[model samples]
Target: MGNISGAIVMTNLIQVGIDIGGTKMLTIAYQHSKIQARSQISTGKDFTAADAQTEIERFIHTLAAPPDGIGIAIPGLVDRAGVVIACDVLPNLVGWQPAIAFSSICPVKVVNDAQAALMKVVSELKPQTVAAVVMVGTGIGAAIYANGMVLSGANGWAGELGSIPIEGKTLDAQASGAAILAQLGIDANQSNALVGANDITALQSIERAGTSLGMGLAILINLLNPETIVLAGGTLQWRGYLAAAMQSTQRYSLPDLWASCRLEVSQHGGDLVGLGAASIAI
Candidate 1:
């Protein structure tokens, strides 16, 4: 499999990428295909868009000089104008217009986090075929690439997978990292709460979340019959969670579709989102 970690140098222009995730925020500066600077900070569940804006401004100033362009990857329904319309995980971001705010500094582009992730790896995907990138972090979001382009519905909200209803509940409420923590009755502010957990309750919580995630994937497979489905995000660190999800996906997905699709784990880790955002800026 092609690795997504190394630099894909294509230009001499300087660009900045900002990834605003449910639990953390990452920022990077790239020039000539190499990262010149990087920064990361924890963002608790209570973190709001206002807090994110402050952090973004601070990170930009820390760069040696202004970048030629900036790209931001964020979770939620972002409109064509880069305004976040709705975000279940970070509801305060609704109506937040980061792109417009930063446009004065440089050309800015804002997109859904999963869409940015798919863009980061579009080169590796089979041409003119359906491919999906699913990120299972604090929330579950996906992006669909078909016919050699990312699919954007009329509202620019084609892949809001996390909010889709299943079994009378939103997928995010049942399958996401936040959902897993909630199932275990753990505090959302506590990081790594599931690591090394071996109790029956913890195991059951993991299984429940994993099953939900698998069901969501099965739905995608049955609907799109994608040639590739790449899974990424911090939650995959839990081996048990991934195992349960795979088993359930295999069980729930149509036999033909399951066999046709190739499931892959992303080689790029925490930096993948930021890199994709940088590419968007380029």
Candidate 2:
């Protein structure tokens, strides 16, 4: 696949992209497809909309020049006006318009993180090809693209799949990274170490997560009948676990639908959100 930066360029205009998550915030600046600056910072315990604004302002100050426009990818439900309606990790941001706060800096656009990732995926696809992206990080979120546009749905809450009920539990409760860590009784910080050691408990937890995720994918397949589905985010780091996930998808999805769709893991890694946000800005 071609680099995401190759898709959009705004001559000499410098733009900024921000990807905000529960634990960290990443910012990048680019002009004419070349990176001018980049930074990442921890979203400390007292995280709030104000705190995020403060950090963003500080990060921008580090750049040699001000950006012409800014795009933000946030992990929650955002409205068309760029207000955060709800968030699981950043509860204090609910009802806050962080984009408005940044208006003085540049034109701003805010969107759901998963939707932003989907925009990046859609940019790489053949025109009008149906696609979906399922992100498994601290939680699960999905976005669909069809006819060269994102399906935002009514109320802009279309891809909040993590909240969908599955076997009397929410998908996130059974399949998210937090869920897997809880099931394994391991600290979030120690997940890599435990998984790397091939701990049986950790492996079992991942398998369970994969199975739950597969069930969710099956539902999407049955409904959207997408041509491609991309699996992404931090929790899907284990290849064996992903294989199990594919197995569950094959088992639960209709044979015809499963046969017609292709499954892929995101190759963009951490840069996915940043690139997606930048795509919106440019």
Candidate 3:
């Protein structure tokens, strides 16, 4: 749709992307880099590691009952190869190595979900933006860039903006999509039903949430000094009222950094995670 119109396109081979979040598990059928089919499954607090695995297989099964490869976005650390360990919200998967068993399902690739969100934005957006994709869905996470190199930190833990301690608590504790929803005493189902997003109400709701988002971002700007911050994920997409609060909070961040950087909502396609996973596999 922009300058790089022909860079990535769908072909005939079957490709799938699986996103496992605290609230849901999503899978899509893609050829080349375009999504052709998609489905979402409920992943409540009761979801277990085995259940997550099952849903993954089922998502694949629905797409021709078999696929060439499946790429997964798990909320944990993945080694260079694609083994998943260390999960936050997905306690049922705590310490288990997925590659050992999951490879049998298909040629699989796995990565931290936050990294996938970052991949979506970086692969498609303009490089000059110096963007940071902050995902508040399931849990809080971010991916940053300077020129073209995505910040990987000392280990693979660099993008975990959620763990940064603030106000005697981490961002996850005070402003996560789930936590914020809980704070407002709104059940996710109710929010989704009312607003078609994990966070709802609009006009009034967007303003307050945007303030919380800005507060969380102030810490990021102070640390990384990115040029633009892109807000992604289901909750942020669903709510349309938080922009004002975000702007108000931005006023207090490092003046020089804020003055230079741009803060805007994300416009990347949904297939970004899939393409990123494919890029990882390739």
| lDDT score, candidate 2 | 0.81
Cα lDDT tens digits, model 1, 29-56, are: 9887788999888876687878888987
- For each of the candidates, the C-alpha root-mean-square deviation to the true structure, in angstroms, is 3.7, 3.4, 4.8
Using Cα atoms with residue i matched to residue i, what is each candidate's TM-score against the true structure? Answer: 0.91, 0.92, 0.80
lDDT of each: 0.82, 0.81, 0.66
**Model 1 — TM-score against the truth?**
0.91
Error of 3 at 165 (Å): 2.3
Count clashes in each candidate, considering only residues at least 3 apart in sequence or on different chains. Answer: 0, 0, 7
Model 3 lDDT tens row, 152-210: 76666667777877668776766666765766667766666666544334335545555
Report lDDT (Cα) of residue 147, candidate 1.
72
For candidate 1, give the lDDT. 0.82
Candidate achieving higher TM-score, 1 or 2 = 2
Query: 2 or 3, which is superior by lDDT?
Result: 2
